[model samples]
Target: MTDEASAPGKSTAPGKSTAPQASDQYVQSLARGLSVIRAFDAANPVMTLSEVAARTDLTRATARRFLHTLVELGYVRTDGKSFVLTAKVLQLGYSYLSALSLPQLAQPHLEDLSLALGESTSAAVLDGTDIFYVARVATRRIMTIGITVGTRFPAYATSMGRVLLAGLPQPRLEEYLAAAELHAITPRTVATRGELLAVLDKVRAQGWCLLDQELEVGLMSIAAPVWNHNAGDVVAAVNVSLQAQSVAAQADPAAYLESVRRHVVETARAISQDVSAKHGDA
Candidate 1:
């Protein structure tokens, strides 16, 4: 029942952000209520009132009131001693997914690509420093964490994220580099901003990205940008995920790279074409 926030892959705890100036139109209470919802994530899906208070930096009394209010609104549900989000929470994300035709159009293409490559495939859009999965088709599980519609991952550590990041303008890209936390998620992760920028340059020029075990220890992925023909901009990215061990069995691993890239790029282009046609821009 709780609504997801604008920033994906992040649990916004109270005191972690500066309070906006109170005004006639600005509602501090609503912001606080949302923060309480944002505090729940894949890692902490259920929590007690005290845990919610600590996570959000709100007083226990304030947290209790928000939880009760959310319960009354059918966003939060209580199970004896703990609180958890309900299916109604998906409505918040569904609104965005419904408004944009990308996810719906990409679904069939993603399924075909996954079957063709014999791997999992997905499409996502950039949301702040994160990329949120909008459509996905899995042939097999490759990551420890489960990914589904509405799942989010850091853009810096993902192939799809890099494709989206590469689409950013110069000023926006620089701003992102300056403000983003470049923490290493895996040993193969690009550790420095300079290295990431260098990689992004290649992505910008090549119009594709092949990430080898960067986001996780054994996962490899290739992604290509989904262009908006009407707007002349990158709107989203599509990717195919592979397991390193499975790829190692290939007769020519080096040659396999080009094959994967071609498949991903073609799939992305097909989706872009669909998007353009649907908007009467083609």
Candidate 2:
């Protein structure tokens, strides 16, 4: 199953540029090469030459050349018939993750929160229309898909995504609302711009978000923002997710969830303080 909350659609070939056709800076070949690499995913980790060509919307000759180039570069491997990405592919994102201090700083806090709450804790940063997971401490699998450091979910459907959205400046937030393709991941997802704007206003004022089964049928999550003191803006979000049944079983479900929200907010604040101390607000 796809880790993303949204339903699958046609994969856009990276080579299909959204940039101006006359733009001198565009690199079509690089985009096509990346498209070939992206053609492999959780559901189709190993694919034949024709399969890769069809997925990437590239000619068989072009796909074969890109695949062989990637294989030679150690980013892909083939066993005569099917090709799969190699561990070396992760190196592509290593530099960015290494330079970002949020994951390193948030890991300990997430681990502690997960230990205390007996739930999964995660940290994510807004990446385009999605929240890209940077660190995770899972006590048990609450989602159908196994969540790992690189997993991504629609920002509109997830607690961490809403927290990040709430942190955005008004202009950017409006731009996002106008451009976002709002659709229902679940019945509870806020799929309308007007509803989402109201929710974001509340989340911004309250400095936290509690999303109940919006991203998935049985999952519930609470999130708070992690700030960049120097920029005075949110750089990431931290959250804890548990099965809805667990909260329902509590003697006082509202109070139990409130306590969890408090813990999540405290952890987020602590991480923000640490970030401020290390990066300095001057």
The residue pairs in collision within model 2 are: none
lDDT of each: 0.81, 0.82
After superposition, the stretches of candidate 2 with alpha carbons farther than 4 Å from their true spots are 1-22
Which pairs, if any, clash in model 1? 1-75, 1-86, 14-56
| Backbone clashes, each candidate | 3, 0
Q: In terms of TM-score, how similar is model 1 to the real structure?
A: 0.89
TM-score against truth, every candidate: 0.89, 0.89
> Which 10 consecutive residues of model 2 have the lowest summed lDDT?
2-11
lDDT of 1 by residue, 70-134 (tens): 99999999985899988888887787889999999999999899888887889999976678889
Query: Candidate 2: deviation at residue 167, Å?
Result: 0.4
In candidate 1, which residue ranges exceed 4 Å CA deviation?
A: 1-24
